[model samples]
Target: MKAFCEEYNIKGGIWNDSNFRAILEATMYLPVTDKDYRKWLNFFFENCSYNQLLFNRIQLNEGTENKMFSDRDLVVQRLEAKLLRYTDAKECETEYCLKLTSVFERLDLLFNNSWKKDVLDLITRLPHEQYNQDEINKKLSFIYSNEDCDDVLVQIKELLGLYDFETAKSENKSEIRELLKYPHYYKVLVITGTTGSGKTFFVNRYIKYCLEKLKIRDISIIPYVFDISKVVSDSNLEQLLIHEMADLLGKSVQSLEDASKLLSYLPIKICFVIENIHLIIDEKSKWNSLISCINRFSRYEEFKWLLTINGYEYYALEDISNFLQRYCIEKNSLLNISKKRLAIFQHAVNMDELNKEWHVVETILQKTLSGRMSNTYVDVNKGITTPLEALYFRECIEGEEWVSSPSTYYEFIKKIFDWKANKLAECNSTTVQSTVLVIVDCVIEKLNCVIKDSELNKSDLSCLRSVQLLSSTITICKENFSVSYGFQQISYRIRVFPYWAAIMVKNRFRSKEFKVESITGYPAELKEWLIPCYIFYNAQNENALLSLFPALKKASLLEYALFCAQRDSSVFSKALYNFIIKNVDYIKSSKRCYSVFYFVFYCPLRISQKFKLFTSIAGKVKEFNLLNLYSRVFKSVVHTSKKLKQLKKNMLELAPCDVLDINYINGYETGEVFMHLSNNEEKSFDIVINDIIAYIREHESILEIIKNGNNSSFFDFFIRKCMENYLKSKKKI
Candidate 1:
């Protein structure tokens, strides 16, 4: 083989694609394996007829019964003797011709017993057709199996989209039991759910079920499960999967036919599991390719199927029976799991001795936290939406310390950042740092949906995927900035802000950029952290480094930060206050000092976080009486937060009156407009318009609402009255 390879200029005696080495090594799928690949290659390259090669394989096994020519060598020896005996050529020809004619007459007897042409073709060719075993038997056998019962139950209700808890729970009686029982009633089981709903986790649960029920450990029921999302872009998804399967099984599978042959040789049942099959649905060719591949694999008795398609793809997959193999069409032939069944699965996999029904979350909190209760936020009445989040809720956000410091959210996110990195097979890569800057930029720009750039590689995209996986309200997939996913989403969605805010602030103080050169879509999904991104940007330049950081030019920027701090956890609030104090010189010198200080004092978290940003501001600028100014803003916030006014004498005597000691349940400045209206003596149209302008322009929150094309009813009423007053004035003129 080496000599022929060298003659043919074939290097290393191997094929071009190195991944095929495993394929070449597999004997179950093809006649030739790694051992014979070189020999076959050498034979094909040789300048000789195929007859010699064909004879070499079967030469030893052929013509054993015939006595005249028991082998090719024996026949050759007989012919040589005839030539050696003759001296004259004419006499030799005449004797040999008569003898050969008599030999041919005898050779005709062996023709009936020789090697069949089709059997040899099976070794060297891919056949166009396979099932032709006397038509009567094929039709009768199929009819017999089809008519065995009026109805056949192959799957649980969850898989069929019935999703009734009781119906799915009854799967233990026969449905689940029949999974490993041969022959399988049906092969394919497709499951679906929303993203982050623990669809993939079910595969593991099912595996455990099979192990516990079958009293076996080989896991051969469906050993090779693949996520089809990765390769859905490829046109030849079927062949790609075949190659993947061949590598896994160490078989040189050439095609679906080769895979079928491979399955035929395996002792245990083999099921092909393709996850996220709906990814290929939009591309008709790829979809047909995938469906055809499954049906082809279905020709073999052992080739069962397991498919998982998410709910987003179900619209395309509805009436999927139109595209499935004839054998898979039955009401109970599919298996899926609902939230209830997932709970059953959760119970089955709880793995905690503390509670048989639920212990994973209990174990997570106990192991990770120092002094957290076992069921801190583990609400048993309202069952799990997803076990991972439920476990996370128990460990991170549900505890007493969850809101006091954002460190828990940071730590949670850091694990996810690295978790995604590890899952992408790029563990501890610098991509995490780069993705932070990318995400921060999008948040600052208020961009929804990442503008996917060509440069963003797999690792960067995986980080974004991690962000999306972190929460449901990530803005990268959001359409309207005005729309909301509820207060909890707004409050906890941007747990990343404080962590990145600290990192960027620290980096800015050191005069550096945090791992950003070029990135595609920033983690735009978590766009609620717009305040932190702006704060980071405000501190970004070396020019500003000498000044100890730039002051935020827009008071709206400062107001937005305060809004986030007031509404959410104190992590971001504390970070922003610290950044401001560190750069107090910039704030003292800026034109918007009063505006910034007003919001800082108005937003309860600033004072509540125990930071004296105003004290530092007062030290730098002595022109304004900072204490008196802070007292006014503090009183306004406190007085406005109340439903009724307190007497000056009573309020003064009620507390020590320290500006920093004020407690306020700060929210949107809804009462600020009413306060302005009440303070003004004039109820005339001109005065009301001035009050409205002052209220909208001076107040950032009201201004932002109006700027965003949204108007409050009170603001709209003022505008309508102003119009009526202007027309009346015009008539008087």
Candidate 2:
């Protein structure tokens, strides 16, 4: 092989002389008289492992004859021993070892075909020394045999049972055996109770008992735990269950269609524990589909089903009475464990005792209501003296008097139980408004901010505040402002007050404009936050704007343009035109107002006709005989306008020149000005004009500017001059 590989440019070698010899010996037994057999032998000798070759030879012997092969049995036993030795060498975890042992058990079941005596002897000698002898003997008693019962098949069954129990517990072995023995009895089990009634616990315990006590392992049964909570959408419950089963079994479930295709191939004897069956039951159309699927499972001789639900007897059982009767009653295929099971559960949780410890009951209730509990407050009438009548009452006892009662602690337990029951009952019917109120209250308390629900306007602020409050209520808001908002909304409308007062109280000290800027972007940030409050105040009182002091001061010239853009886009355009015309002299005289105008007009009005107006005004200012200040201001304004137009095009497309829009514009313009000053880039009027045209084309919403018949040609002339000046500047550069 090495010489041939060298000649053909291939690398090949064999290691372990004993393994090579084992492959050679195994290949000799492959009935190699035929060409195909001889070719297979050659391939085996060339590449197969010694253990694989030995296994193949043993399988061939087993397949050659109908009778059980002793050689095959001995080889399998040796393979099992080898696997045990390998596991021992690594000191594998128990789960790992059990997986290896399961493979051996499967092989023995397939190849070791013999009487009970031989199987029992093999089982007794297996390396899994943890086999329960008593359970094995009990399983052996069930294996039928003729005169002086052949112990081989009986022993094999016992061994298999013991192996399966040690490897992985079987959940529905007893149910299957009972069904097989008493086919006339109903096999269906319908378990129902109130929420937190321990139905799931009872079913799990029953499954555990069968796996430990009966030792009827190797029963191909799958216990599927189906949570109906996920079935809210239009998903097929059957396909979902099958997919879940495949996932738990570590098998491929590519799609719902694929899951359906694999369902029939699944082992017939299986237990499906369908939890929260009410989800399907309530959707009548879906209930029909679910029933159809269940009927199919019932038709299989070995299939068993278990359903768990809360208050299922309320509607589900009644709705599906006919279907339930046919399968559960006539077919002896259903079992109703709701009532009897509840009694058993009551015993488990000790609910029968009236004198339970408050702490113990509280812990259990808390666990049961995980992710569902809400902090709720009930108003109490002044005349009501009993605890039950009091808003914070513990059960029926008066809050003050309850603590003095002999059963005070028990009363607390009863109160929690009653509260939990009421909460669960209200989950579906609670109004959106009431729910929002509850959530907002909790959020406010958590944030240490006092808030009253009545103070908030439901129609205006409810939608936004409710979402923020609920998110905060869930303990997801870790930021300081978010927490403060929750507290303020719940306790008081701080954002509604004058910006200065709100800031002073909110920041817990004297809050300057600069300080406010540090916390919330620039003046625009404070202005935007005040808009909603202003709108709310305006809606209530027309002169509400008078109450807004800091907001008025914080509203820079640019923000004023934006505020008009939001409230009146037409007014915003006109105001922007006048502001640019008035500021042209100042911007051209010095760079002080140039930055402010660049931010207001060039940035916000990039897509508006206001850009043309600003450029035209700047050109007029530069043309007029003022002083050297006019030239300097015009240069600064023109330079900054070029960069501002470019920055605006990139950041804002068809941006509304409103306060909100200008806030984003301000940030972009600031960055652009910084970049220009740092890079010392020369500016061109043509470049600036072209940038504005490009921005206009991108934001087609502003194309109306070109169509406006009044002074349309004047706008064109203004842009043409700017473009000419820009191209001239570019040539110089």
Model 1 score (lDDT): 0.38
Instruction: For model 2, give the 10-residue run with minimal summed lDDT.
Output: 399-408
Per-residue lDDT of model 1, residues 1-733, tens digit only: 4433332231223232221222232322222322254454344336333467643533322222132112322322332333233222221123323433342222221111111111211211222123432442333234323222112222111122222223434534244334323223344555555443444554544443333323322122433456665455345666677777666555578876666545433323455556656555646777766766665555444466666664434445444543332333222222122233322112111211112233443344344444632221222312223345445445545443212112223344344445443443433456665655554454434434333343234454433333332222323344466575543211112233334444434443234443221112234323223234433344324333223212332222333333223334344444556666565544433333553443354344523232245434444334443444444544454444332123211221212212222211111122333333443534565665565576557656544544553333323433554465556656998
Candidate with best lDDT: 1
Evaluate all candidate structures by whole-model CA lDDT and list the values in order: 0.38, 0.36
Q: What's the CA RMSD of model 2 in angstroms?
A: 25.6
Candidate 2, superposed: residue stretches over 4 Å from native: 1-187, 210-220, 232-235, 250-268, 312-315, 329-407, 414-733
lDDT tens readout by residue for model 2, 328-392: 42211112124433232221122112112223233333333345312211112212222122222
Q: TM-score per candidate, in order? A: 0.35, 0.26
